[model samples]
Target: MEPLIKIEHMYKIYNPGDDEVRALDDVSMEIQRGELTAIIGHSGSGKSTLMNMLGCLDIPTSGKYFLNGKDVFSMTDNQLSDIRNQEIGFIFQGFNLIANLDALGNVELPLIYRGIDKKTRQELSREALRMVGLEPRIHHKPSEMSGGQQQRVAVARAIAAKPPIILADEPTGNLDSHSTEEILQILKGLHEAGRTVIIITHDPDIASQTDRVVQIKDGKIEKDYWNEKE
Candidate 1:
């Protein structure tokens, strides 16, 4: 099967006066469909830069990125925006939910942008909440739920669109051990259900749980290995 994401000699450079910083240096990678992959690196190791490129939020200065077989860098800004919304779901370290929006509303926010009808959006949002085992908290606001519940709601929001890929950046960074385990299980379930899941994390324990782990350092890949037992 064709890879869901293909990167070839990717380079992202940030310029400040005469100084240039290489956030990603000739990074090449391929992510297959339905596979759970983790990008592990310390701070300033270029993992976040790679995530930005993968999520289509930032374009590389050179090299090529093919997302689902399309030349991502070749797309116009408007087209890239549309693809970001329709093709990829993102879960952040901070649960970026609207304070006023309840669980269902938060999950339906993206569908609203897609111009999905209210009835259908609500139905699908409820289903998403159910998928994350958040049906009982659909009416609750973010402030009213525990960190784990809020993160689960965020997961529901990410999956609500049924996007082919889910990009999670430090998803468990703020949760306790129990919550981290809960979140990991939810992510594992998503992968098992055939969704492409890519995570960026520094935590070895978290990285160990994925189907494959890619270690990066100094803006380049250091190792890429599959956990045979997982």
Candidate 2:
């Protein structure tokens, strides 16, 4: 079967002169559909650059990125925006929820952008909130909720549209250990339900929980391996 995502000899260079820095130095990888993968790297590592590329947020200086067999670089900005909206769900470290919007409202925002009808958006948002164990908090605003609850709301918002891929960047970076565990379990459940989940983090503990780990260092892939699950 064709890989869900493929990147070959990818390079993201900044400045492009004598002082140029290669954020992604000739990196290449393929992710199969429904794989739970982690990309681990420290602060200066190229993981963030890779995440930007994967999420279609930014273009690489040079490389071929094929997402679902479509050439990513060849797409226009509007097309890339549509792809980001329709094909990938993003969960960021800072629970990017609207302060004025309730949980359901936030979750419905993306569906609304997709031009979904009011009735269908409400249903999908409610179901997504339920999946994240936040049904009771549907009407609660972000400020009224705990950090974990807010993050769960963020999760619900991301999955409300049922995108095929979940791209999470340092998803548990701001939470307590308990909250971190909760988020991880929710992500695991999403993976079990057949979503292609990719987590970007510097924590080996988090990476260990994923099915596959891809370690990045100094803008290059240092290692890629599958974990042995019992």
Candidate 3:
């Protein structure tokens, strides 16, 4: 199968001269479609830098990134924004939902940016909520739901557009074991149903649960292993 995401010679430098910090150093990797992969590293290991590149949130100093076969760096800021809004579904660890918006509203947020009409976005958001098994709580605000449910709302928001890639950054960072597993299961379900899911996490257990693990240290990849245990 063709690769869903590819990065070559990626670099992110914080300072120019005497005080140079390489958040990412010559990182290159390929992620195929529908694969569940984990990028694991401690704080300041450049994993987040990698995520920023993959999500098109930041441009690399020097490298190439192709998402679904389109060169990411070749696009302008507005085009990059469109790439983020259309091609990738982001689920952050923080949930990041507006407290004022109910689950349905939170799920509809992204669709609104895509110029989706109210009636269509509402139905799509409702279906996404149902996919995450949160249909009954769609009307509840984020503050009214458990950590897992809020994350589910976030997931619903992500998949509502049916993006080709699901980029999750420390998706379970704030949840208990059960909630973490629940969210993981939902991500896994998405992968099973043919979505490329990349998880950025520090937890070994979480990394192990993924189909493949790529370890990073000091801004470079240490090991790229396909988990036979899976």
**TM-scores of the candidates in the order shown:** 0.97, 0.99, 0.97
CA lDDT, every prediction?
Answer: 0.94, 0.97, 0.93
lDDT for position 161 in model 2: 94
Superposed on all Cα atoms, model 3 deviates from the true structure by an RMSD in Å of: 1.0
lDDT: which is higher, 1 or 3?
1
TM-score of 1: 0.97
lDDT of 3 at 93: 89
Q: Write candidate 3's Cα lDDT for 1-230 as tens digits.
A: 65888899988888867998989899999999888999999999999999999999999889999888889899999999999999999999899999999999999988998999999999999999999999999899988999999999999999999999999999999999999999999999999999999999999999999999999999999999998872
lDDT tens per residue, model 1, 1-230 = 88889999998888934898988989999999999999999999999999999999998889999988999999999999999898999999999999999999999999999999999999989999999899988899999999999999999999998988999999999999999999999999989999999999999999999989999999999999998891
Ordered by lDDT, highest first, the candidates read: 2, 1, 3
Q: Single out the weakest 10-residue window by summed lDDT for candidate 3.
A: 1-10
1-230 in candidate 2: lDDT tens per residue? Answer: 99999999999999999999999999999999999999999998999999999999999999999999999999999999999999999999999999999999999999999999999999999999999999987899999999999999989989999999999999999999999999999999999999999999999999999999999999999999999989
TM-score-superior candidate, 1 or 2: 2
Clashes of each: 0, 0, 0
